[model samples]
Target: MYDFTTFVQSIGNFLHGQFSPGVATALEWTLVILIYLALYAILGLVLVYVERRVCAFFQLRLGPNRVGWAGTAQTVADALKLLLKEPVTVNKADKLLFNLAPFIITLAALTVISLVPFAKGLQAFDINIGLLFIVAVSSLGVVGILLAGWSSNNKYALIGAMRSGAQIVSYELSVGLSLLTMVLLTGTLQLSAIIETQANGWWIFKGHVPAVIAFFLYLTASIAEINRGPFDLPEAESELTAGFHTEYSGLKFAFFFLAEFVNMFTVAAIATTVFLGGWMPFHIGDWAGFNAVMDFLPPIFWFFLKVSAVIFLMMWFKWTFPRLRIDQLLKLEWKYLMPLNLMNLVFTAILVYLGWHG
Candidate 1:
């Protein structure tokens, strides 16, 4: 794999050569931290704006066009508004936890961004247990949601949080199984290895039927896990009245909002890396001309294009489908998705064992 982070770090070391080794290392880390922060800010804002525009398009309405050119800065205006607004505290709420929940969730979402390989060499943290770290860190937002609901002293909030917890916990199994399908095929847990294995062809193309099934399963489970509309019981406003973050206001609310938006990107990035081939260009066998055409574009462009495709699919689900009832939601996962996941995992394992995988 190309090492973009190392290149940047080396530049930092060279620039700070007069300083001690420890100081230069610290400076290198600081540069990396700033890059991540910029990514969080830019990507978070872009997702929100794009989602709104997509929803408006689906609804046959003109989206935000007044704030800036086609309302590109609408989310930025909203963020500033949130920043200027005062945070209100609920007297009956658990003060400490209430204040802590937003930051915790936001931090959880931000942490996973470091592990995703955006391009050939543009990864921040490339640990051996990369996939496990993603799964474990991705699940941390649930704790913040649970705490927010509990601290709010609001029945609606509590119910929403519990629903979110149940939903994420159940769907996580399907998501994991879907990912495991690829892991079994590739015989590796490292995300970079997974991507490289698909260099000749994406897993969806290579694994055929079972991989296709797992892809869809991962798609559906990811949407539900993130609590987006159609699976958004956690924030079912008609029922839960704003859900777990109901009592949160101002900057605190902004934090939760940022976490949710960024989480969507995080999920989409995972999908791109796992199924579509992270930073890998489309290559067709024995089609030299076509392969060269595909390779002409930069790797980052290919990566973003794939991520956007997945994100758009997620947005399509959010806008087109009706929110599922809690019972129906649980049933869909357990009775349908879970069964399919188990069968698919077994089938994939069998395929690998028989040496039939392409």
Candidate 2:
């Protein structure tokens, strides 16, 4: 007879013997949470500086140079200022939910980081359903946005929240569809498994035309999902006066701002994992010498390089494009992106069935 409990206990005992159970558990959870928090803080500062520089380049002007070495410390200073500033609650607003919303948004952003594989074997949790876990946790940000908007008791806040809810919901379908194509091709939903499948070649290359199309669809859907420019109808400055966070001041507002930048990197990381081969290095077709050279570089470097390129593309979109109207946004998603994504998934399935992948 199969002793399921004993079998499970044996496995647990094995793991405990290999790694001190109490210490390993504590260290693993701590490292996961700390890495997530540290990445947000560092990336938030870098992105703010990069955005200013990029915007300045486009406008033909010098950007922030007053603070520590070309305004690198500007975000840090801004963070300190926000921390010192007092938070104000509107008279008619739901105080608890209103205050809780920003924290919720921030937490949601951080939670998705756990599933992201920074390098081979570097992921915090190698959950079998890692990809699905990410999608589910990321969607929770919408709830936070809705709560924040509704609790503010401001008309603009309500409008922003409603727009965000609709926009995120529509865009999420395309994102999911794009990911489904990858899952179908790889035959597993685990992030690490997806990367290993791409060891011989990146999915964007291996899966051919369908994968390429899915990549673009994923990019567009991600931009919309993050509520970045073009799809930034929720925070339309001209109309909503800062949108859902209009009534929030000081540290509360800063939390919302930080969440946006973190969300941007989160999307970029997902794109890296799905399409660009996570931390897999470049390889030439059967070229052992070139592949060996590529392997010398750390996995984290490849992961960062891919993610940074995606982030730059996003920043370019933000600075270059004018915001789209809400209705136009929905029309683009439903009429174009959805159909294209579905077709890509079908094509990917055919390729996988035919063993055409590299």
Candidate 3:
């Protein structure tokens, strides 16, 4: 059997030896950034198409299927249209910051991917502080949103930006606290190490009640953080008319849309990594036959499946729920989720101390 750990280490070592330290680091970062961009493009296309199909199915109507083999090329056509269109800048807008905002938001969305582990032994940095780095960087998107809104010099844009800033800042605490419970149980911040720690069992199962509660809290907070559905006051079409990007058009608008989709996937992927065992295949306790069957599946498949499931759940919630008022949103986070997460963390710590986990 090929030793996967050694293979990953060998690849890392080879890259290090093949280039100077600076060059190697640059190359690694370049590779990660490129992957992030590529995935952002692909997922945006796929998600748009998928959302259409899902909506059609729910409404019992036919979806896009005429463009290119069941409408597969529809997104491609949309891309070309956007590329050919001119980006319009609003009157009195700050030209420099107006143009810079989309790039900043996109970059912030892409940066989070570096810390996400796609499969066993497959991560970009695998830094000891991977979890914290992701949380910190992911939150920076709010700055870009605020900049976009303020720079537009439009009342609606300013309102959208303000809502986004408040929304993300409020929800991020719950998300961080929930993830902290997992880190405490696993005793590591590296995504790879956290996954490895779950080799025997997923934290969701191994940590029992606390893990379950944290998972739900993480889900709720992530929804608000990404500004999806019920929490999407920043872009409430009925209210702010496209939110922070109200004044943006053409490719600039595309950048914001792409970043939002990528952010959604990133949140789902992180949740899978922290609580759902990431690329680790499902296995029952000491079931050799079951494990053997599970092992036949590649690690990436497991990782993708888990992340996809989380995305579907989010989408379901989005379609089924009504938007919350800003005050209600904050109250849910601070009054309820924050306190509950604190208790969950303490309970998890006690469980760990009591030798309740594997």
Candidate 4:
């Protein structure tokens, strides 16, 4: 029965079963938007909270304990502070672009949420070209960044924006390759199909060393893509004093900030789905007892565990590695990851062709 010809038809079947087709269809669309919006807000709050606690753990300091039990409410407070502030504007800045940029970036990130599969039957849309769509949509945020920096009419902001543009554009190559490496093995570009291909075991396990390498490669490039910590040259405080967003304040600034944290979740989710089997629980071939134990846990739990592991690793990099010089950052991408990824893809293709992937 789950052999859905299309995701839209699947939704229609479920909605029609519940109520009048007309009302159910309208309700489905309305609820989907609300859910996505709630998810967007919740992602920012949860990420900020997690990042603070994780940061404190590394620094040997108590984080936001005073705000709300163990600082749980700290992000909530921060959100309120931003929401209440007056948006400031510079006279010389291009008001139109400055105002439009944050929305563009935020929308780009939000659009990807609908394309991801959180669970087997849970997703907004399951398109055939999910991978290509995600990559394209994910890259559109750069335009907003460029506009934000340039429109601000501040040289520092402009420089920061340019740096961010260059960094994301370069690292995206590695990200694509890292993902394509796994796709080569799985033989599908569909996100849901890729996850299903790993029903027996995660790619990192079945595909072995090459898959492991691609995972790390993707992780590093993702860190740079999100502009976090060491790869955060675009917003280097000591250098650009907040960089491209220096002129941003209030809700506008919040949008940019929200997008960064949400983007972190986006990459982590993609990594989880590609490398760790999306919402599929782990299973070891021929290990009946162990497989049963794994199956006892919900698929969503397995998915979260994998994504959390990836997110924690990213946090570790942020807390440990010092910011790389611009030259070093670019070199790491071009001289290192790019070559490694290409070679890995070729090798992976050979392995697939020989039926040796498992």
- Using TM-score as the measure, the top candidate is 1
Off by over 4 Å in 3: 1-29
lDDT of 2 at 174: 93
CA lDDT of every candidate = 0.89, 0.87, 0.88, 0.89
CA shift of 27, model 1, Å: 1.7
Model 1 TM-score (2 dp):
0.96
Task: For residues 178-282, write the lDDT of model 4, one tens digit per residue.
Answer: 989988888888888998899888898999789999999999998898888689999999999998899999999999999999999889999999988888777
Task: Please write out the lDDT profile of model 2 over residues 26-71, one tens digit for every residue.
Answer: 6556755786788888888788788888888877898987889888
Query: Compared with the true structure, what per-residue lDDT tens digits does model 1 show for residues 1-358?
Result: 3446577667866868878888887877887889998888898899899998999999998888789899998999999999999999998999999999998898888898888998766787888888788888888999999999999999999999999999999998988888888788888888788888998899889987998999899999988988886999998989998999999999999888888988999999999998898889999887999988898888888889999999999998889999999899999999999999999999999999999987
Summing lDDT over every window of 10 consecutive residues in candidate 3, give the lowest-scoring window. Answer: 1-10
Off by over 4 Å in 1: 1-6, 12-16
Query: Which ten contiguous residues of candidate 2 have the minimum total lDDT?
Result: 1-10
Q: What does the lDDT read for residue 228 in candidate 4?
A: 89
Clashes of 4: 0
Q: Which of 1 and 3 is ahead in TM-score?
A: 1
* Candidate 1: residue 264 Cα off by (Å): 0.4
Give candidate 2 regions above 4 Å deviation: 1-24
